[model samples]
Target: MEKWVVALLAMSAYLVFAFIVGVLAGRGRSFWSVSEYTVADRGLGLVLMWFLMGGTVFSAFAFLGGPGWAYSKGAASFYILAYTCLGLLPWYLIGPKVARIGARKNFYTMGEFLGDRYDSRAIQVLVGVISVLAFIQYLTLQIKGMAYVFNVLTEDAIPIWLGALISYGIVIVYVATSGVRGAAWSDVLQGILMLLVAWVVGYTVVYSFHDGVADMFRGIEASRPGFLTVGAEGSGMSPMSYTTILLVSVIGFIMWPHLFTKSFTTTEKKIKQTVLVYPLFAIFLVPILFIGFAAVGVVDPAQLTGPDTILPHLVTHEMGASGIVYGLIGAGALAAAMSSADAITHGGSVSFGRDIIQPLKPDLPERTQIWIMRLSVIAIGTVAYYLSIFGAAGLVQLLVGAYGSIVQFAPAVYGALWWRRGTSTGVIAGLVAGIAVNYYFQLVQPATPLDINAGILGLIVNVVLFVGMSMVTNPAGSRADEYIKA
Candidate 1:
């Protein structure tokens, strides 16, 4: 058989296996139950929770963009590692509280949790709109990664749009049919597969191209001086930019609607355990960066299409026609992209059904809501697919841009949980102001004052408005006290 054919077959096998596993995961679960489809009945075990959380966070961005940053931006890539380490710390304190409250209130989405707390439907609708928009940006990156892998490994036999449609089409089927169970179970397989591939590929590429890991760095350091050091002269990123990005990530990490809703998937004890063990997953990313650094001098920058393609480009060209190597990289990259995409897709559907549709109609039947969520899987996937193909931003760039808006939810979330003075008008005003300021800085003006992350700047304005308005506005009465007590 030809090399590309053999490689394609290997990738095809993995996709088939993932489809079977994902579909079967929903076999015994209640398809019509809104609770079952959205949060696995809030009974997920520790192991499943670990992989679901890890796999969802470490998306194609980590597998592809991690190396891309190392290859293109040098040490600035370490921000990914830094943020991952600190991001979940706040979750430890907040996750249990949110889980307890969610369980009591029968909350399955962040919008529901906030809407009930602040006593405002407008806030729920705003959150729904923000979450779905951010999800599309996020899902776009994962689809791009999947399409890039199939197109490259298959030698472009599978066009970008078709490849995305095929892989994500399977994801949509299992997610729509099986719900969160499909996403969680499949993540178990994907999480294990991608970790094994990352280390093996990272080790092989380093030695294949250079004497060793140490020698690989030595060559780059000697040739490109300061590329390995952040904020150094010629490093491509300044210290303030790096610092602000890191800060925003830590604040915004768990605020992601998909991740926040995970608080309802399992118990409070398991939530803390997941957060504690989450840092080890960050270790898996170290080797992923090695793959990018290994390519520094070996591959010419001008020849490659984009920094994100460096990984697959090296695997196909330098691995000497070994179909196994091509297949391994293809499956692993797909795993990274698919794992995250499934969860985001599932979350987006739930958000649409629960936050946007239910609040507006208020009397929609439970069965009708489930069907809407199921159909939303296709609708949301279609929008994200269009963006993935047409969007010009880099993977990490897309992620950070999404984070700015998501981080805007921080004050409202924290206030709902702890503060008694929080009022509906205050939450609405803060959320709107924060989102507007964030957009203005992010899109309207790229050059921010003092080089702070646009998200952080918006957050500053958001806090002021939220607090100032709440003090003047009447408290939410006994309901606010009851919510905080819960």
Candidate 2:
């Protein structure tokens, strides 16, 4: 067989395997039960929870953007490693609390949890809207990654639109059918596959063009001084900027609706266990950064269209001679993209059904609710796919912009668990204020004062509003006390 054909077959084989596994995950489970579909009846074990959390957190960004950052920004890429290690530490505390409340309340979505705490349909709908918006943007980036992988590995034989549709279509099917279980099981496979591929590519590249890891860094330092040190002369970001971004992520990382909702999928002890072992996933990412650094002097920066293309470029130009290598790289990239996309798609559908639609039609039957959620999987996935293929030229910017607003949920979430004085009025007011301030700073005037992230500035305003408004308003009283005691 021809080289491209062989590569395509290898990638195709992986996709087929993923589809079978995802579809089978729902078997013998209660398809009609909302609890079964959304949280697998809250029975997930340690192994499944570990991979689900690990795979979802380490998305296509780990494969593509991680290398891209290292290739373009040098030590600025270390910020990813730093945040990944620290982001889930907060979860160790937050996750168990959330799981306790989630089990007591029978909550399956963040909107549901927040809405019940605040006793307001308005807050629920607002969270649903914000979550869906962020989900689309986040899913768009993953779809784009999947398409890029297929197109580049096949030498452009598969068009961007078709590649995205094919990869994400399978994701949609499994998500609609098997729901969270499908996503969790597939992630186990994907997490393992991508880790292996990352090591293979990272190690091969480091040794292919250089003597060794030490020699590679020595050569880079001698040629380009300070490139490996952030805030240094050649570094891409300032010290203040890096520090603030890291701080914001540590708070916002668990606040993501998809991740927050995971608390309901397993026991509190399992949730804590997952967070404990999560740092190992960060260690696996070290090799991905190696690939980008290996190409620093070898690949011509001027020849590439964007830094994100560095991984594919290296695979095509350097490893193209071996069909097996090309196929594995393609599969690895697709795994990274699909693993996250499945979770986002499942979360979006559940959010749409429980958070947005259910509140609007509170009288809807359970069967109708499940049907709506199933159909929502297709509806949300279709929209994300369209945006990925035809939306703005800068989709990554959209994800960054959405993140600023996601962090706005921190005050409301933390307040619900710890502060008896918190009220629905205060939570709603604070969320709106924080999102508005975040948008203004992030998109309106990105050159934030003091080189700090716009999200942090928004958070400052949010906390002030949250605390002040709560002080003046009536407390949630017994309801708030119940959650705190949980």
Candidate 3:
């Protein structure tokens, strides 16, 4: 069979398999139960929680973008690997407490949790808006990554728009039908497939280009100095930028509504176990960077359209691997993108209904809320799909922008847990100020005095303002202490 045909068939089979897994996993749950839809009735075990949380973090960015960074920026790509291990460790300290409160309060959304703690509906709506924007930004990149793979692997036999629709459409269906259960089960399959495929591709690419791993690194370093390590003294990213970016990501990583809300899906013990096992996923990502480095000397940079294009380019032009290998690589890339997208789509919808719409209908029936969340899934998916196809921003830029905005939520979240005095006024003001500062740095003057991301700089202001505002305002006599002590 022809190469494109083989790859296309493999990708198609992968999607069909994923769909079956998703639908089946959601089976036997109560159709009218909002808890079932949003959190699998808070009954996830250790194994499922492991995949659910693990797969959520290993996004399309990890698949395509990880390699892209390694290929383009050299050692700067190591920043991704560095942060992943640290990012989820804090979950051990916080996840159980959050989950316990969520179980006690019947809270399904982070916005609800925050809004209740601060005694402000306004904060809920504000978080709802932020969550929606950040979610669409995050989902757009995953859709774009899947589209890029389909476009390249099939040699444009599948156009970008159509490819995105086909892939993301499956995600929307499973999420709408199965909800979190569907997504969690799907992650079990996707996380396993992508991990295996990454190592295979990473190892194969290195050997295909040179004698072995040592020779591959040596060849790239000899050709391009300072490309294999982080920070200056090397010709890579500045040390401050590298260190601070990782810090921003690690701190803000759990603050993402999608990841944060996972607290409601499983037990406290399961969440802790998931946190313990997650670093292995970080370790699993190392070989992905190797695939990028493997392409350095072998593939001409001038032929590539973008850094993200390196993986597909290598598979088609340079790997000299069999047709099946090409097919598996394509499937693996889709698995990465769709696995993360389903969870984000599910989480975004729940946030929309709970944060944005639930306030409009506080007395709405549980069945009604469930339907609204399902509808929000489709609506959010459509908006994100449109942006993915037409948006001018690159994947990395969109991700960075989303991260900058969402990281501002960390102060409010952590404050809810530990700081008893944080009021709604303080969090709202801090969130607003953080976003403005972050936007100015991101768009108005991207080149700051230092190589620091605007997000990190914005975070410093965000924390300071939050603390200052809370102290001056009358603190809520709310159950801030109760939630903390629980």
Candidate 4:
């Protein structure tokens, strides 16, 4: 009868539904083979691939941090729109090639793809280390977003840590048991649920105060000018920073280990099709900006401690904590968080097993490797859970930090695919240099020439060093030729 009780019930029900879906989806697959466990035996069709990719991207950030950005940062949030439109275009060109090679080489991890290209375990190890760190960082943000949703909705009936433990625990179990198949099927539910909830809730929040979406924005402009456009001097980020962020995101997004390895889970054509249909997913996310913008003038900024909490605050206060409304919000937010967590957690585990553990043992049985991957979920999940509660960084900060590191992978990945002269030494040097430059810009300087994104600046340095070293160094032509033919 009470609001918290209804919300608790709704969230609990959603968890049960997710667990059932995860387990059932993985039911008939052979669990003994590493490929079966990690890539669903490379049999995912177009629809499942579509939802899996979409659900992975429409993360807890999209639900919480997205609106938070809109609420706090204004026009800077439009960068998400810009990046989403342009990001996957490069994937259409690269994904099919990667998928074809992955099928031939029996590669299920991004590290495997690159390490083989350069004939270097060091490359795999580098990718493994970077990917694991980035995965934990990413999972931490989503878990925080998830926990925040639970804590705010139940009025702390479910505290942040406990809420994370309960929901993320489902993610661990499903991923450990079902592997990528579990993650993909659960994403089907999550992808559809979240898109619907985002639109409904976005419209609801806007219509609450103003007659329509346009009126809502107009009122915000009248009340808080410069909140709708970038470089407006209030909450707007620099235009140079905005455009650079979009450019780096478009280049680096598909380079994420989870998204890159996804190429292995389906056919080459399916990979292309996934990219072709992704713009619709981009369109689906626009209204979430409205939800964030809706709360700007109406809610006092001083009242809430952080912008990340703004959306939840709106649901609890503006929706009058209505049982059904709050319940749907919980279900949707849970979908957003859990969906992304499962893929990331699974990808981290696979990277650890395929890249880290399997190479160390070399002769480890396939079954043993699968077990290591399954157990790696708990290991990585524990780290992410602990960090989610204790980490000092905010949601957007963590996501941005992780993105900065991930884009550095592009040089190695693209070199393996297209550049015949891309030597192992050169790729390794470039990756290290890129990350170093990125971190230096990120923490030490915090300002770049012309206000370009730190990541892009890092990429420029990375590319120069990579190309220069490759020109002087002997090309790994035969290996690259083999890859190209695949």
Best by lDDT: 1
Write candidate 1's Cα lDDT for 62-131 as tens digits. Answer: 9999899999989999988888888888888788888888998899999999988887888898899999
TM-score of each: 0.98, 0.98, 0.98, 0.98
Residue-wise lDDT of candidate 2 within 160-262, one digit each (tens)? Answer: 9999989999999998999999999999999999999999989998888899899999988998898999899988889998898888878888899999999
User: Which residue pairs does candidate 1 place in steric collision?
Assistant: none
What lDDT does the true structure give each of the candidates? 0.91, 0.89, 0.88, 0.88
Model 4 per-residue lDDT tens digits across residues 310-373: 8889988765748888888899999999999999999999999988887778898888898899
Model 1 local distance difference test score: 0.91
Could you tell me which 10 consecutive residues in candidate 2 have the lowest summed lDDT? 392-401
Error of 1 at 123 (Å): 0.4
RMSD values, in order shown = 1.2, 1.2, 1.1, 1.2
Q: For candidate 4, what's the RMSD?
A: 1.2
Backbone clashes in model 3: 0
The window of 10 residues in a row where model 3 has the poorest summed lDDT is: 227-236
Candidate 3 residues lying further than 4 Å off, grouped into runs, are: none
Please give the range of 10 consecutive residues that has the lowest summed lDDT in model 1.
477-486
